[model samples]
Target: MKAERRTQWLRGVLDLCILGVLYDGEYYGYAISQRLEQAGLGHIKGGTLYPLLARLEEMSLVTSRWTVRQQGPGRKYYVLTEQGRRVFEEQASDWTMFAEHVATLIYRRGE
Candidate 1:
């Protein structure tokens, strides 16, 4: 039940986090998942992450390209578009304010 609730909460801002990961540079799916986990976002499943990536691509928020290395299978790397950068900056501010409000409500010292 706790995990389910956390998953629901994560869904609300996972896109922003994904964009945050790409803000550094291009990364393939597994690397993106690793970055998210490194940031304490837990492991984002491909079932959730890939479709969201496709949606972001559809919305022009991100772009992807497939790259094949000599030693490994091809990987579709994703990068944040210029529009994605703008959206990330704006929504990140909004999320910050929203989180602050939630924190205030939840952490009030007195009733």
Candidate 2:
């Protein structure tokens, strides 16, 4: 039950986290996954991240381009679109408020 709820919460914020990372600069799929993991979001697999990237693209929140490397196969890099920047700002504000409210509730002392 607790784990399920945690999973739900993570799912809700995954998009925001992804956007936050991309807001910095473009990154390939594996690099994005590594960044998330390094940020303590845990290891997000390609199975999960790729579809989210696709969805963001479909929504016009992001754009991708393929870049070829001499040592290996080409990689698809993703960048946040202008629309995505606006959306990220809005979502980040909402998350801040929501997190503060949750923290207050969780830390409240009984009167």
Candidate 3:
């Protein structure tokens, strides 16, 4: 599996993934990207990530707050809204089923 192939697939589910991350708690932009990579999503750049965050905000799926820090510049942290939680739950269930079906086809398992 090449990186480009994965990137194409990722676009379809990035929003759900971001919501899934926020489900645990709040995270700033950079940390969110780190968590995504840690979860094997790969490195998502700001150019790609920030706009998605903005779109999520616009969609009312997530809300953000800026926390001031004495040590350095403040960061905007994002958290999932109540509606976002519901949406995530629904999408996650759908994705799980869809992924299983896709895997079955790809692997020719249970045929």
Residue 10: error of model 2 in Å? 1.3
- Could you give candidate 1's per-residue lDDT for residues 10-109 as a string of tens digits? 9899999999999999999999999999988788999999999999999999999999889979999999999999999999999999999999999997
Ranking by lDDT: 3, 1, 2
Candidate 3 backbone collisions, by pair: none
> Count of backbone clashes for each model?
0, 0, 0
- Whole-model lDDT per candidate: 0.95, 0.94, 0.96
| Regions of candidate 2 where Cα sits further than 4 Å from its true position | 1-5
Judge candidate 2 against the unseen true structure and give its global Cα lDDT, from 0 to 1.
Answer: 0.94
Whose lDDT is higher: candidate 1's or candidate 2's?
A: 1
lDDT of 2 by residue, 53-93 (tens): 99999999999999999999999999999999999999999
Better of 1 and 3 by lDDT: 3
lDDT of 3 by residue, 1-111 (tens): 798899999999998999999999999999999999999999999999999999999999999999999999999999999999999999999999999999888999566
Task: Evaluate model 1: give its lDDT.
Answer: 0.95
RMSD of each: 1.2, 1.7, 1.4
- Candidate 1: where is the Cα deviation over 4 Å? none
